[model samples]
Target chain A: MPKQVDHRERRETIARALWRVVEQRGIAHASVREVAQEAGISHGAVQHYFATREEMLVFAMDFASEQTSLRVAERVAELGDAPHPRDVLRVTLTEMLPLHPEARATSRMSAAYVLEALHDAHIHARAREGLTHGRDLVEDLVRQAITDGHIDPDRDPAIETNLLLALTGLTPLVELGVIEPREATTTIAHHLDRLFTNRP
Target chain B: MPKQVDHRERRETIARALWRVVEQRGIAHASVREVAQEAGISHGAVQHYFATREEMLVFAMDFASEQTSLRVAERVAELGDAPHPRDVLRVTLTEMLPLHPEARATSRMSAAYVLEALHDAHIHARAREGLTHGRDLVEDLVRQAITDGHIDPDRDPAIETNLLLALTGLTPLVELGVIEPREATTTIAHHLDRLFTNRP
Candidate 1:
């Protein structure tokens, strides 16, 4: 069991190294050697964990997504038990945006991976899984808001969920300085306000 | 004048070849040599038009955006004079989505260029310009809609414009099969219906 745990920990370290390389030099430069150097390990040692650069990139992407999810979970947990659906959503979606420096880096990495998905079936499947999971979570919260009379019952939970997800798609604009982070947050709040019009 | 025209046309041909390279083989494979082969020209010929791969890429990105804009303009023109703001908006927005194969390929190319924009300042500036221009056009239409009493006056035209632009950000999801193209169009229509609620 300890051996297995060590194996997982080693992989995580390598993934972290890959992320650092991606953040510092861009995904295009995140080769096995570069990541190995970033991790302060031998290139073969890195390959022991990830045989190919694609494999390493995929693991790093999953690791980054998991980290984001954990951060979102922490923020949501701060709301205490039985928090409002609106607050839960706001926290999750805001974390997903590239508003802050760290989130901005993560968003850039995600953008690169999405493009990579076009050429790599494994990456595409992973991206699809992440998108579907995010959609399901948001859809559930939207449905709960409706049931609790926080939002209008007539609103289609599915459509509302998709719109909210789509709204976060503006992260690139925010990153490009075309949309200010404050304005992006405001737009989210505005959209939420429209949806939660029935709040009592 | 003839010589100038030929120069411009030759560049266009090279850019088109770059697009074909990107469409068939993801942007990573879109080297000057590959594009030259695609264009049925010598590597030196492509170099004659674009001294570097980066220069070629920037030109190709601009070319693609211009093509998309022209297509959108043509679609909008089909609405004829004084088309209702809603129809104009719908046509423009729908045209932006990757609902069809050509649009989908273009969307993939755009996604790749967006990631490239992270590393290349020229591409980033171009992306910002495109985003800003798109935002301005949408904002104007939203303002006109308000003036015409198509949408409620209470809505902030800027925010509404950002939301609509952000909504098209879901092109990646649709490409990943996380959302059907049909479902995406429905979401757009549904959002439009909500915005145009004040329609008489």
Candidate 2:
């Protein structure tokens, strides 16, 4: 009898291989043949899962976003009604950091896709959706903080949301050694504290 | 007799063509042959100036950085000695925005080079140098703001510098229409005003 493979497991394996290729060679090289080689499969095998390179890229980008969301949700769940907006924001934003191998790999892959999106409309649309989703999550958290009286009521949610996203973009720069990590972390923390703290 | 182009002018033309190709077709298609065709020159003609694709990329990346620096320097020069630090910072950061076509093209090319830097060591080195130079400029401005009593003396320069750079990275997202441009601009302006204002 032919060997039976778990379909979801195989797809995950392929996605993981795609992430590695993106991380190691940049997304420009995340072609079918390249990802197949990384996945220890034939190009046809990759085609079996993804009809086109765009399909694979879209799936991979979505997968990464989902993973990040799940991670943040898990962490937030653990927070268990933490009233402090700063604490909630810190946990959510820091979860996106490349503090471990998994997070680092995901970040590299996501960054590659983001750059790729600038060139490909399909990827661009998906990236926009992902960005909106992520921004919404952070925005909601900020709103929650306000509702809980953790953040200054006078603060603008729209401004704080953009600031948080901007800070998140600095993580890959730090991971890539473009900025000193300690300084990046300290700078982000200080800015966050200022945004959250009460001051006359 | 064949016309002889000035070496510096030839190289600059090739770099501009490279950037145009990047903006038109995305960085994924920025090969020597394509760039040469875009410049209406022979492939060998491109090599005459750049030697190799990697060298071309580095030169192109440097050109973009230089463009940004020149713009900022020109604005700073106009400010003279009595310029407000807040105004200087706002103007300098705004120069990095993809508000106009030239800046937009440059921003696209820079993003392409940034993705390439992830996998190309030479490109990565150049990117690191460019980022460091930018950060240094921001740090100097931050220090000046403090000395001018435009910002809080207790505000950390390092963090402020990162915040400024992070804000630059977020601009493309807005320009690309991945995020609402109005929201981005307003949010950035609000944050900068809050961060740099002396009145607290």
Candidate 3:
């Protein structure tokens, strides 16, 4: 038999090269030839994997999203049966925060993808879908929290979900050290607490 | 007599070219030659102003921040004497949000700068300073709101200011239409009202 070739693995290998490029030189350096050089592959190999640069960018973004989702799922799986709704929400949303090294790494790439989403329809759709999925998940959590009497019953799940979703956008400030990690923690905590309280 | 050259004007023109490059092709295409071509100047002219690409990026980011500040100031100046503190804040912050066409344009460039700030120290400092300046202004408004009895008497101005400052980062989502303009307005309104209330 000829040498075995796993196309998926090769693609991921190329994607990792893109990640390395982003890490070392930022997305400005993630050209096809540059990524190919990083991956120790020929230009044809990169072309074989992605027909266009936009396709490669889309795949990289999707790959990053899957990594983040896996990290969240891994943590969620480790939770005990019927964990406090607040704690579950916090832990799940923590992956969206740049409070940890892993989340910070993913956020680095995610931010670039967000900027790209402005000019690219595929990226905009993917990002919009990702954000919608996140907010829907938040709505479910809010409902669960309300049902468990862990949060205020009067909260509008839609707006509340957006509020929580918007807080994740603050991660770059934290990553930049403009806002301390403790401050970001406090802000997120305050938002969650306000949701739970009925006092106004 | 020798012709007089305004260095500031030259830099701004080059920065405008960078902005146009960002606007037309995204920042990924903002190479020195491209920006020089866009500015109708020579590559040596671009090199003359900034020794390195990083230096040029810094200048462009600073230029954008200055542009944002000027727009905010102009809007504030348009308001009547002692306008409602809430309205003042809403209008000022609306500039920071991608709720309008102009803001969405600046935000396109801004989000790209933010993503770059994560890896570049100089960009990080510029971003940090800009954010700190914003929060300080928010603190001033929060103080005025409290003094004027427009907001809660016991609110932590620091946290409230941070909350408002962090909200500006959500412009990318708004640009992507992940958060509709009405929703963003509602979110900001809710946040401002919460600050003004004794809500827990």
Per lDDT, the best of the predicted structures is: 1
True contacts kept of 2: 0.62
lDDT by residue (A150-173, candidate 3, tens digit) is: 778877777777777777767767
lDDT, model 1: 0.83
Clashing pairs in model 2, backbone N/Cα/C closer than 3 A: none
lDDT of 3 at B60: 83
lDDT of 2 by residue, B1-200 (tens): 23455876787788889899888777877899999999999998898888899988888878887887788778888988867777677777777767677777787777777668778888878887787777787799889888878888988887788888788767646845756656666766887788777843
lDDT, candidate 2, A1-200, per-residue tens:
23335765677788889998887787778899999999999999889888999988888877877787788778778878743667667766776767667777787777777767777788788788778777787889888877876689999887788888887667646755867667666766787788777622
What's the candidate order when arranged by decreasing TM-score?
Answer: 1, 2, 3
Q: In terms of TM-score, how similar is model 2 to the real structure?
A: 0.91
Model 1 docking grade: medium
Ranking by DockQ: 1, 2, 3
lDDT of each: 0.83, 0.78, 0.76
> Candidate 3 lDDT, tens digit per residue, B54-132?
7887888777777878888788778878667776777777787766655665666677777677678887888878767
Q: Return the interface RMSD of the candidates, in order shown, one decimal each.
A: 1.5, 2.1, 1.9
lDDT of 1 by residue, A1-200 (tens): 99999988999998877766665567767888888888999999988988899888888888878888888889999999988788888888898888776676567677778777776788889899988997898898898888889999899998998899988787878877898889989998999888899877
Model 1 RMSD in angstroms: 1.8
Task: Tell me the tens digit of each residue's lDDT in model 1 across B61-152.
Answer: 87777778887889889989978788788878887788876676566667777777777788789888987887898999899899989999
